[model samples]
Target: MKNQQLQSKGYLMISSTQTIRIISINETFDPQGVKIVYGQGTFSHYSKDGLVEDSIAYRAKGAAAVSVAEAGVNASGVAIGYLDIEVKDSDKGYKNKICTLVIRSFIPTTTANTTFVPTTSAPISPPASEENSKQLVNPVPTVAASNGYVNTTDSSNIPF
Candidate 1:
């Protein structure tokens, strides 16, 4: 399937089919003193129409929390990572669903001394010229899979 960044909303089953750029990481503790880590980043994916972009915030706990913390410590400015999130029916009286964050991979940086500065303006796409015609079309065939999953046969055309 074509790789795409998973959505970061609660009560949804999602996973990163491709690596995502971590713009920032923050660490905190829960009421019980358990460590929690939060990562903020931008996720982009190619849709049948065009490029789709969204802001993502992921929370990690337990073993995943430790991994995110380690990555944040080593990262000079940003980090690149993959995440898997599963939502299940919650047993807690106060909540209806529980979300779990799994860190598949986390790297401090892809290039030396690199930094990411988020802009308030929308992303500018290249002009639709003849040379860029191929990029304007959907690169893969997508099918709706069960449980809110989108499947693509060729992920090679997915833009990271």
Candidate 2:
């Protein structure tokens, strides 16, 4: 082995493989109300002669495609932010070797399509009153943040 290509003692190499790899990512989302969201898991590294830098820069195209999108009134995807990776090699019990990455997959854009043809037109239903119209609404009003919540994922928000 060459003197410049040797691994150091202590937490070096991903697991004694003499090539410990470090990773970085953007784990959260800032969907400016586009009705859609996307994420990518980027990773890359070149073996160093010594201590590895804590932060690595990912190529703009290096970000892996998370290709997740949802549409509709109240839709959402994965939690936004970094990727949570678990690494092990008889070190630190293989727990939390990497930081917790949250996936920002929720981006509110448009609501449900109103043009959906009614199922069987209610057989010549009588004109709906103001109170009745309110009740007929598909989504019941609640304390939902004018912004959607992660508790539920509605249609249109999903690529399907």
Question: Model 1 over residues 12-100: C-alpha lDDT tens digits?
Answer: 43444434455576889999988878766555678997999765666666665666666553242232344443355466754343322
C-alpha TM-score for every candidate: 0.36, 0.16
Q: Look at candidate 2 and tell me the lDDT of residue 52.
A: 37
- Locate the minimum summed-lDDT window of 10 residues in model 1: 1-10
RMSD to the hidden true structure, all candidates:
22.7, 23.1
Question: What is the model-wide C-alpha lDDT for candidate 1?
Answer: 0.54
TM-score attained by model 1: 0.36
Task: List ranges where model 1 is wrong by over 4 Å.
Answer: 1-17, 31-33, 73-160
Off by over 4 Å in 2: 1-79, 90-101, 108-160
lDDT of 2 by residue, 18-70 (tens): 11121222334335422222323222244666543343221111122232222
Which lDDT values do the candidates have, in the order given?
Answer: 0.54, 0.32
The superposed Cα distance between candidate 2 and the true structure at residue 4, in angstroms, equals 34
